[model samples]
Target chain A: MISSIGRFIIGVFSSTGGVVILFLRTLYWVFIGPFQKKPVKLESVFYQMGFTGLRSVLIVFFVAIFTGIVLAMQTAYQLEKMGAVLYVASLVAISLCRELSPVLTALVVAGRVGSAISAELGTMKVTEQIEALEIMAINPVRFLVVPRFLALFFMLPCLTILGNLSGILGGFLVGVGSLNINPYLYLQTSFKYLELKDIYTGLTKSFVFAILIALVACFEGLNTTKGAEGVGRATTRTVVISFILIILADCVLTSIFYFSNM
Target chain B: MQRDYSQEAIISVRGVSKEFDGRKIIDNVSFDIYCGETFVIMGCSGSGKSTLLRLMTGAIKPTEGSIIIKGKDISKLRTYQLDELRKSFGMLFQYSALLDSLTVEDNVALPLREHTKLDEEIIKIIVKMKLSLVGLRGFEKYYPSQISGGMRKRVGLARAIALDPDIVFYDEPTSGLDPVVGGVIDKLIKDLSEKLLITSIVVTHDMQSVFRIADRVAMVHKGKLIQVGTPQEIKNSENPYIKQFINGLPQGPIDFFKEDIGILEEFI
Candidate 1:
């Protein structure tokens, strides 16, 4: 069992190392002489972002709202028993701004956009379309990856804001209407307790997560081997890696924030 | 039987070798594809036929040696240069790999729209002409999933010819088609090649298509191109591997049992 665990770790390291090397090579081509001059397909970028990010608004909105409501319900129940129902707003605000919003939004995006990126690029790789692009003097990285990376970089922040708004609205409905809290009091307390740093930190995490998700998805898709089976593996790996990375990043960022305060 | 040497070859592959992992798949293979000829690459499964096509097409680089397309060493071309070279040849994949999300017209129009400065109106005309050439004139809005495999292949052909490429590479064009459809595809390939005067490299094990359309057939065996000749010469060639493969004989130089041994051993 220990040996198997060691082998798995070694395998992951090698795989990651391979991906890094390929990514660097792609970057070199992207920045270098010939490839840089190739015309950027702006239409492809907008189309992909619209398909990957915009079309996913409903899913993210639904997930965020439900998460906020559930958090409010659970926290209000415990806090009310302790005669601290007013602290429920703080709990919802702090949690959403600090941890839940960014991480959950990333998870939702990974499920929606990450898989789509991997599958789209993977299928392109499988069908030799990527190769066809390369043969056409179009840099696959520029033609495929750059647009996606840019789309996700810009769109994830937008999704994060949307997620944050919907989550706050959900908590408001549950806490103010159902829990019979004073609307003015809930609003005042949430505003008072929530620091700008908390919101900034969440947004920063969303940015990093977006970059991570895009990199992993494009990397896996670009390097897809075998055929259909390879595509499936790439999609699975993108999601799993994005999920783990988001959590790890959240923990690290949280530590940084806490330590800075200390 | 010598091909005319005055006309410069469009694609010249010299001493190419490719290895996957540690195993050599394509070993020092060399060939020159002229501008207006149907060059058929024939080999049994796993004979590195497809790999050769990929190397020639610049899809994958040879580990050793070079591929020169139209006086440019494609293996040495920058990404953009290679892309320009790639535009010269349109490839039809074995599965007729039409993008499922795209309609037939969109798939056919993709290359023209991507690489050309032609207006959208002109692109549409080109798309229609190409599709009509392949007898898919009215199936513009149908997605790949909505079409039959044969229809998908025709759509793929239309896409391949959309840009009026100097060369077209068809990877096992008749692999999955019925005899009737396969013959139709072969005729289409022949007709298109003739009408457009485009050089074509078709990789296939389909013997009937080989006889029907190939101006010359190059038989690849165990990484080396064992023979290159006309269809008649290939039939008469005494190379045991060529004879066994072309005749589909179970016994002889090409061992079916040895191939099965690896799989059976894995199970055991």
Candidate 2:
């Protein structure tokens, strides 16, 4: 038992080290590689943007809008007794923007984009494609991982913004459609308590979440061994680890935002 | 089977050994490969020839000793230096390893696009030329999955020669193909060696290929060099292991079931 626990601890440390090295390598390629005659291709970055951001709009909308509706209904249930049901709009809008939208959108993207990247890279690793790239003098980290890293870093924040808007719309539907609240009053209440900092804080969390998803996914993919089984395992681990890190980061950021009054 | 010593050796493997998890996969093995020669390394599946190929490619570092390509010790080079050296050679994987997402033309043009400042139209012409050299003309629009296995291998050959490198290493070039297609690939390897003056190192267990392409052949068994000679010399070799391997005999000094020790442990 002790030996197994020791092994687990060592595994964690080594993998953490691996991820840090990958992160540093990606940063170097993005910022410094261009000056050294190794520019990152804009075409590759745009292709990745289409995959991560454009293709993901519908799923994010569905998830965020539904969460918004459920949230509005639940808050109104208790607020109805207090005769303050109008606060439901403000509550859903604030919570979704400050926490739910960023975390939820990241989780969805982590499931969709993160798993695909890991599985793709894992298959390449096993099949000698990555090795082929290496033999051709192409740095796999620069060629394969950099565009993906930059795409997630920028696009996740945009996705979170979309999620924030859809969620507010969902809450508005619940507030004005069935709850008999005036549409104008619902809009007023929603923005009355909401601040610019709330949306930006969520966007900030998304940027952090983007780093986590890209690093963990690419790290897992690049290190895949064995064969198809290894690729499947890497994909699963990417999703699980990204979800954990997203929630963990959200919790920490929330506390900091709360305590600092920013 | 005597070889002319006039040509200097381009690749020299010196007492290289590779170990994995405390187990030696490639024992101390040394050999010299001359410039513009097709040297075949043949061994059974678990015999570590693939590991040696990877070591020479600088994909993995050796546990001990050195691999020198054109007198520069590959083991000692920095990452960028190694990459610089890597651009001087190309490798063809058993599975072809073409990027599945790219069309055949894009795959062939990848090396040029990444490493050259050539115009797109110039690259397109070069891609067409390389594809035609491998007898794969007009198949440029197809992805790897859209082609036959034999065609994929030919496209892989086109990709390998895309950079016009001094050395080309092939892993199991004809492992899964009809005998006729295999002959075509074998012919390509020979033509590339003689016509392009390219040094070719092929790793395979296919006896037919060994005899067909190699100017000098090396047989490895259990991670150790058993014999190195011309096809005729290897055909006439008295070494029991080589004789057994070449003949595909069931009875010999080479025990077939000894490899099952690890598999048996897995079950128990």
Instruction: Please state the interface RMSD for every predicted structure, separated by commas.
Output: 2.3, 0.6
Fnat per candidate, as a fraction, reads: 0.49, 0.89
For residues B247-268, what per-residue lDDT tens digits would candidate 1 score against the true structure?
A: 8988898775887888999999
Give candidate 2 misplaced runs (Cα > 4 Å): B1-3, B258-268
Clashes of each: 3, 0
Candidate 2: deviation at residue A133, Å?
Answer: 0.6
Q: What TM-score quantifies how close candidate 2 is to the native fold?
A: 0.97
- Model 2 chain B: weakest 10-residue lDDT segment is B1-10
Model 1 residue runs over 4 Å out of place are: A1-7, A18-40, A73-84, A136-138, B1-6, B258-268
Residue B183's lDDT in candidate 2? 92
**Cα lDDT of model 2 by residue, B1-268, tens digit:** 3457588789999999999999999999999999888999999899999999999999999999999999899999999999999888988899999998899999999999999999999999999999999999999999999999999999999999999999999999999999999999999999998899899999998898889899999999889998898899999999999999999987788887666866898899
